[model samples]
Target: MLDARREDLGRMLRAWRMARDPAALPGPVPFRGHRTYLTQLDMALLLGVSERWYRALERGEDRGYAREMIDGVARILALPPRQATALYRGTGHQPPRRPAGGVRPDAALLDLLHQQRRVSWICDQAWDVLAVNAVGARHCPWLARADANVMTWAFSAEARYQLRDWEARWAGSLLGRLRLAWQRWPDNARLDEVVRGVRREPGVAELWERTADTRETSDDAARPMYFPLVAPDPVDVRVAAYGRFGDTALRWLVLTPEDPTVAFP
Candidate 1:
């Protein structure tokens, strides 16, 4: 089984390397003595590892590379979330966790967010806003605030007026998601701070206490929500959240209008 796992890891690494377009790498193409699809040496340079070490891993030598190194390779390869998770598991490591602080959305994710017609934004496990499309910013003005977090916004006095069915729709759901995130990353200090702060808000503590389930559930029905700054008209929108493959903690939240007649300004 161990040998099989190593073989699988090597096969995946080689396939990903071959599939990657050198021009699509996150930054400017390196001044590789020559340019084609990234070569093993180029990958080694990008990963800050000796070519021999990278080659050993790709050859299934099982040299016991550090988790950080594996994660760096995944990032450099721009592996899809699922493929990245598989890489970690094949190497017998826990998948990488979302950073507590905000993270920049990769080019692919950013492009997807921009392509969406609905209000859409991406947040880390701690609910820190990582990126927001123009529609998302227009509809959610608070997201533009410095260091904005979903927990802080949902529990704020402003949310009481903005979000309809505050207890069931926004509060309960947000708390459930937060609870899930906390359970996954109990040691994250920033997450602890956000939880503590939200618990302090009036009435929030009781609501949180009532929420026993931590798993996130889908709510398919469209619900009325008011965006006072952007749209005075009450809009029926459905909130959809998509978790990335490798980084399950990083999620894309999209608000789509149920009523096609109601348009975003």
Candidate 2:
């Protein structure tokens, strides 16, 4: 592992570059002396960026570097797990996660999810299921599936039978939130995978193309849904949106029954 002891991003990057064997990399050799390390210009050429742009980025003078560019640098430098995360943070970013739906909720988060008396579910930024409360599980047993995603299910044909009004109450609003997530974390591979999954279903691609529903949250509005085996009747719910420990990467949702006399069945 390369020494990331240096707090400076440029220094860390330089160290990583120097640690690499120039001959091992697939690139034209630099003409200069020692032949021990790849130069900044080499990094720039590999990244498809201008030398000035890469220099500014290395010097920490550039704060607006794109996620793809950072990812490219990480791949090119072959940064170790810890060092990769550090590089991302030093560049005012977060490291990309492995595969889609790989997020594991910690004990505290799992406890928080189980504590909710109301129908609730916890998901990662990609809307992949992390935890589903027992109450929620009974209401929609499909959530118990190993690879369940609320957004993906919402757009599926089976969801039409479960939701009250699949298009207006759920589709537009739900798709809006999905689109918003895509906009917020375009570099998230899992999130991109989720989007692709949704669009593959008939009519979803057309709906996604529409610009009318960009609202991130699904609160205030009625989210009418059905639990056929459990409730039989459609339940009007108010969707409460939240993030775990102020981290947007994890989303917590509580579906509160609207009527005071009514409770989740």
Highest TM-score model number? 2
lDDT (0-100) at residue 25 of candidate 1? 50
CA RMSD (A), model 2: 16.3
Per-candidate TM vs. native?
Answer: 0.58, 0.59
What overall lDDT, based on C-alpha atoms, would model 1 receive against the true structure? Answer: 0.74
- Over the stretch 1-265, how does candidate 2's per-residue lDDT look in tens digits? 2224323777778788878765543222323466767788877765677899988776656457887688777755656778788777777777777632244567776777778777788888888766687778777765654456788888889998788888777788788878888888988888898899899999988887874558545347777777564466887888887875667777888888777666665
- CA lDDT of every candidate: 0.74, 0.72
- Please provide, for model 1 over 1-265, each residue's C-alpha lDDT reduced to its tens digit, 9 standing for 90 to 100: 3487788789789988887777655333334444546778877766667899988888877777887578677766767778888888877788756432225567888789877767888887678776677677677766644356788888999877778888777777778877777888887766887899899999987887788876555656677789765467767788888866877657898988887766676
Error in Å for residue 3 of model 2: 42
Candidate 2 has a TM-score of 0.59
Model 1 misplaced regions, further than 4 Å: 1-102, 214-218, 228-232
